[model samples]
Target: MPQDGPQPVERELPTDEARDLLGLVRELVQREIRPVAAEEEASCTFPRETFRLLSHSGLLGLPYAEEHGGGGQPYEVYLQVLEELAAARLTVGLGTSVHSLSCHGLAHFGSKEQRTERLPDMLGGGLLGAYCLSEPASGSDAASLRTRAVRDGEDWVLTGTKAWITHGGVADFYTVLARTGEDGPRGITAFLVPADAEGLSAAPPERKMGLNGSPTAQVHFDQVRVPDARRLGEEGQGLTVALSSLDAGRLGIAACAVGLAQAALGEALVYTAQREQFGRPLADFQGLRFTLADMGTQIEAGRALYLAAARRRDAAKPFSRQAAMAKLFCTDAAMRVTTDAVQLLGGYGYTADFPVERYLREAKVLQIVEGTNQIQRMVIARHLAGPESRS
Candidate 1:
């Protein structure tokens, strides 16, 4: 398998159109994103220009149909673009992933009028979006989210706080999953809430260990009101929409993890060639060479896992299990590869003087977000042994 800098030739690869889109994204990443990546990540600053650039390039709406002002690209192509972005900067990749997740609930389930009214702005403009599913009490158990949305005549009064909301106050809109009924997952409903809605407030950004440029916070919905038309789907379909969206979203995270791993591997390869010990290059050592080999192997495995899952999605096959497996494997690979990249760089890797440290820090969150690795394992195990296996 090819490692670092060049796209590997996989068996039965993407179509010409997909390849073209992938190439376009890579070019944008190299020219526009890579230059500012270090600085923006260091200062915990979101690159608004990057968001605008992507939106203008028709990349922001890649997975949506062409009729909705999107590029009419498949998830396979869209995910490769995400990989390219992650290789350049995790913050951008993650921000894009969150944006796509927010879009998923609406794109799949919104009424025609809702789609016609909102999708144009969402797909065409440089508007950021947030997906609110997690709460202080409900992370893995998303169905248990306490945020309440009570029907009030023609509107819904939303109250309660959502935690770990990506884009938080910065987003132009939010996809909120809240309880409209009394049961667990079955009781939930989803809504497309505007950021400017009254009583919606964001706490100061969380101080995370990595992906600092991607702001996250607790979003409090204090009796915020929205028209019933803003509902994403029927009352109980909220969990359905959220879960299906997460299935696809996991693949996006898998791609991002691969990109991050590839970046770290590239950094390590370059550093080993340049850094010498005892008048010999570090790369010349068998141990270091083996380390690089392992990193390359793990990254290749991750790439294959995600691509297979993406292909399954494109084929409209059942891919939830595959998506969860890919997310778990790739994120774990990222954590290992990035740590090894830092090890290869010696003391310099631990400092901001090199990007490997940042890569390591950025890689850690991949294991935690989208869904925790533990949750991913549960998803995979359930698929392997069937639902009765839980008994």
Candidate 2:
């Protein structure tokens, strides 16, 4: 007979502490996340309490500095944790990634006073965060974002609409990028805007095909005033900050994609083995076995690719190209693997009873988020063949 559930992924952790961390994450997923994931996602319920629990457990800040109330884990270990969480629920996994991405500018470029004052609470004080970059008119061409941040002495007045923001309305804070000078990348600047700012509001969450449990909406900033203290890097440095954050964020998305693919593959294994036809289980059929092998291979390869890129990041090496490659390959692999998983399950896969169909729907968004796969290819090509001539 087939094995019970998906087998635990055997990770090559760097230390005992990392192993223990993964163990705790797995336990938490089984007890809190996986059991209710299907139901809550179907109902479009946000797991606020679950995220609070993760904050209390220090899972939300696994890849940041120790002195800042973070877990001080390396990217390799932290990414593995993301993979485990994502396997249980994409909303939780992707939400955690977005939260980390929201923290990037403040943590990396903020003044010492800023880090000392705000980093701790944001990282571990039960607060959640959202990233604001893509606007309604500037999804791929982020440099063209029209959000305006005009200086009014000590405070800046921000006005614009940020589109497709995860945790849009519910987040405690937002990391916002807006134009501060002339048009294009050089004019943009980053800010840490409180969610309750006077003029900041979110539209109704978009009706998405999947990940309904995590809210994605358009956030409007209408003359929202922010103190200069909230500014992240220097004025006109927003694109630099945003690009750096995206390189790391892409790796997080890659890990999530692998986790999602792994989940679908596990479901396929158990269902095919138990469901029988022609006096035999589906596992016995050579055709199905080959499909299983391909799925397993893709998941493993994707995992390795993301991990390799993560290790490069941890080593303080140039990993932008590798990160883009990981994000591109892993997400595409997830789409293929999840689609094959649905096919392997036959009619049952088409129904809501099994989770494969949901996985298939979720996998598609990965290809589009954190810079679409097309963008990833462009980044890689730029690295290899230099930037395209703007003729």
Candidate 3:
């Protein structure tokens, strides 16, 4: 998902088409999404229709191939779109990232036939998706997930619970991870599961701090049967698929974090300039201006960090470590910047009267999702110092 703050400097797009696409996105956000962001979020309402509208606009499939009904944009372009969405609302931004993550396994690892069969609908068919890997007992240690998917003739029987699921109850489909063999990472396999499959159900959405417009819940698969054709990749290749999805998903989160920070900074700049104190605008004060400067610097650094990683990804280079670093740096920067945004607004930021309060709350979760910042550090350390010492 995305972050908030600061005015977006002019972006450097590679082509006129890319610039036009961004222009459309900005117009859509300004007219449809941003106006209702606060009200819907305060009501904890999921904007299903808005997502459907996004699907119809081809905004949901920007990063996939054009042949499959996708927009075929590079990660560089796709990510800036995410940044713009996040600046409008974190729920919409993170939802877009998670939707892309849900499609990753099938897009990258499915057979040619599977790609031809599934990609079109998944990319632009007005369907929302969720990625299922984390369970109540297994979060960071996804290798130990207990979800089971036993082969049953032409189908597979899935049974388990997935925790912290975004769009858990309302997703049209799920890219699920389940055990199909011996325990540990090797046993896991990815499966495409229809949301309405028999025995599939969702727990109530969790009470969360921010992005209340996005629902998070637990999903249960009780002997849910999926066809063999739905399996993604080889039987034991699920971990590969999962990790690869996360590698890309981490970059999405980084972009969202920067966006959220930028949004928060924008709000702060407006407030400080209009707010009067000591017979002068708050912007005229050195202390708050220095704070604003630091906030702007953090937002820019985070944007640069995520964009650098996006470039590596677009170039087909090995970028997991850089992705991890970007995820870590951008999210941490979001946490700091958004918090400062609230502080800059003083007591008003502490209440629902201002959106900066919401930005701060949303920023906390970025440090946790798509792998915690701690996990990102470990991933980066592994790339640098070699894998963790087992002793």
Candidate 4:
């Protein structure tokens, strides 16, 4: 594969319209996203304008209902588009995924009136969003979150800090999960808190090892009041909403992992082909050739895994297990493939001159985000052997 930039992804689109959509996305990636990705990411600059451009292009809401101003694309189509964007830049790809996850509560469970009132602006109205579930102490055990949302007459007063929140300081809206009852799972409730809500604030962005172009920070809701109309689903059903959103979000993460691996492999292939070792090109050596082959194989495998899960979702099947499997396997594959990429590039790969090193750093986060790979394994095991037995 040529590595001037992102190579064309071999997609299996279902229709001419889907094909056209992919074409449009690729053109946008080339023209708007790729050129500035390295510079912006290096400077740790969040590209809010790029998100706006995607919103205007109807990309931010691709997998939701068109009646609510989404693109109405299937998960399969939407995910391939994600893979393409991630190959160009992870900040935009993963940011769009978080936005989609934040929209899930309202899109799937909000009252019809609420949908009519807010879905339009949210789906494509140039609004950025963040999903708040991880608390400082409750990263993997999300049910243990300490954020509280107590009812005061008609409004719910929220008070707590959400940790590791993507788009934290910049989001126009936040999908917050907070405690409303007793401890454990049933205590949580989901609410859509506008960024301008009283007492809502964000701490400075975290100094992350990668994806600095996408801000991750702690969002503080200090007695923030949310109207009852903003509540999503039934009371004490927030964990369900959060888990369901994560099921889909995991697939998005899987696709992005595959894309990153593909980018790394492409870079490795290009570099090996040009670099001379002894009397021959590095690619001519059997040992290095095997590494390249393994990387390519893993990337293709990851792509297939995520696409299979996406197809099951589009078909309205029970795909939670498949989604977990995809997330776990694809991200692990990405870590392996990206590491091999760095090895193949030798000393230059260790440097920031090439994108492979960045890919390696970025790939590490994918294994942790959405849900840790360990959590994904637990999810898959639960689907197989049933929920864990608590003492």
Say which candidate scores most in lDDT. Answer: 2
Tell me the lDDT of model 1 at 151.
95
- Model 2 lDDT, residue 221, Cα: 98
Candidate 3, which segments miss by more than 4 Å at Cα? Answer: 1-8
Displacement of residue 226 (Cα, Å) in model 2 is: 0.0
RMSD of 2: 1.3
Model 4: residues with Cα > 4 Å off, grouped in runs? 1-3
lDDT of 2 by residue, 1-391 (tens): 2223477999999999999999999999999999899999999999999999999899999999999999999999999999999999999999999999999999999999999999999889999999999999999999999999999999999999999999999999999999999998899999999999999999999999999999999999999999999999999999999999999999999999999999999999999888999999999999999999999999999999999999999999999999999999999999999999999999988988899899999999999999999999999999999999999
TM-score of each: 0.96, 0.99, 0.98, 0.98
lDDT of 3 by residue, 1-391 (tens): 1223345557888889999999999889888888889899999999999888888899888999998889999998999999999989989999999999999998999998998999888889999999999999999999999999999999999999999999999999999999999998899899999999999999999999888999999999999999999999999999999999999999999999988998998999989988999999999999999999999898888888888888998999999999999999999999999899889889988988788999999999999999999999999999999977689
TM-score of model 3 vs. true structure:
0.98
Global local distance difference test of model 1? 0.88
Q: Which is the winner by TM-score between candidate 2 and candidate 3? A: 2
Clashing pairs in 1: none
- The lDDT values for all models are 0.88, 0.95, 0.92, 0.92
Provide the lDDT at 368 for model 4: 100
Worst 10 residues of 3 by lDDT: 1-10
Models sorted by lDDT, best on top: 2, 4, 3, 1
Each candidate: RMSD to true structure?
Answer: 2.6, 1.3, 2.3, 1.3
lDDT of 3 at 313: 89
Better-scoring candidate (TM-score), 1 or 2:
2
